[model samples]
Target: MTTVQQSFPVPPQVLWNALPAGVTAIGGQGPFYDAQRGYVTCRTGMTFFSWGQVVTAMVSPAAQGSTITVQTALKFGVFDWGEGKRLGTRFATAVAYAAGTAALT
Candidate 1:
């Protein structure tokens, strides 16, 4: 498992709207967004080094704007060899871009 969190200078709704695009950027599908619950999940295809991964993003309100915590877990494996971390970072970065806001310091 791996997790990456990013803060953006935008509302939670703005970040939520970018969840789908973020999933796509990481070669995943179906963001399965739950606005009321403030969470999203995606299913990634199998890769050469991985069986597959389930990527989830949790959105929360922040004082500055919003914070998104992206987590990636393998479908079947004890270790992902950094693949999960990479995917989580990719998803978070894509969401920041799609939200039209840079990451907060």
Candidate 2:
């Protein structure tokens, strides 16, 4: 299991949208998103033989915009090879870019 947290300068919904899109861009699949709960779950799976991954994200209102907490768990693994950190960075960058674009528009 791994956890990554980031603060975004956009509303929760905006950040939420950015997150799943980034995840999808990098092979994440079957995202179950819940706006009311500000939560999203995506299956970051590789081979069908494996149970895959459960990537859960929590987006909450924050001082400037929103705070996102991402929890990642593989179906079964001894440890992660920094994949969680990579995913976290990817989502954060995407969210920031989206927010900046939205603000400019």
Candidate 3:
């Protein structure tokens, strides 16, 4: 089990909207926000693993900006752990890209 955490300052809606679209194809989609929880899915590639699940919890907001924290737990069944790590890395890259895109808009 590995835990990855990141925190940055950005407008709430900017981060939220950018995040879902970033994770669209690689087993990530359908990001919904609710009063209690935020729901999203992440899938690892077949090369390394079959599937991956990432459940994110929306955190509190800052005065000037907001923070979105995602905690991902990888479960690789009959798959290479390296693949899972790569997927995680890709996800992070996507998040960073989202942030950058939001800044541009």
Please name the candidate that would achieve the greatest lDDT relative to the true structure.
Answer: 1
After superposition, the stretches of candidate 3 with alpha carbons farther than 4 Å from their true spots are 25-36, 49-64, 74-80, 101-105
lDDT of 2 by residue, 1-105 (tens): 778787766777778777656566547788787888988788776643344667787889888778878787877776667776666666655656766643211
Using all chains and alpha carbons, the TM-scores for the candidates as numbered come to 0.94, 0.77, 0.56
> What lDDT tens digits, residue by residue, belong to model 1 across residues 1-105?
888998988989999888887888998876587878999898898898799999999999999999999989999988898999899888888988888878988
Model 2 clashing residue pairs (backbone): none
* Ranked by TM-score, top first: 1, 2, 3
Model 3: per-residue Cα lDDT over 10-98, one tens digit each: 66665666566446534664555564444344544333254565545353466646655554555446534655455545555576577
- TM-score: which is higher, 1 or 3? 1
- How much is 100 displaced in model 1, in angstroms? 1.2
> Model 1, which residues run further than 4 Å from truth?
none
Q: How far out, in Å, is residue 28 in model 2?
A: 1.2
State each model's CA lDDT, in order. 0.88, 0.70, 0.51
For candidate 2, the TM-score is 0.77
C-alpha lDDT (0 to 100) for residue 9 of candidate 1: 84
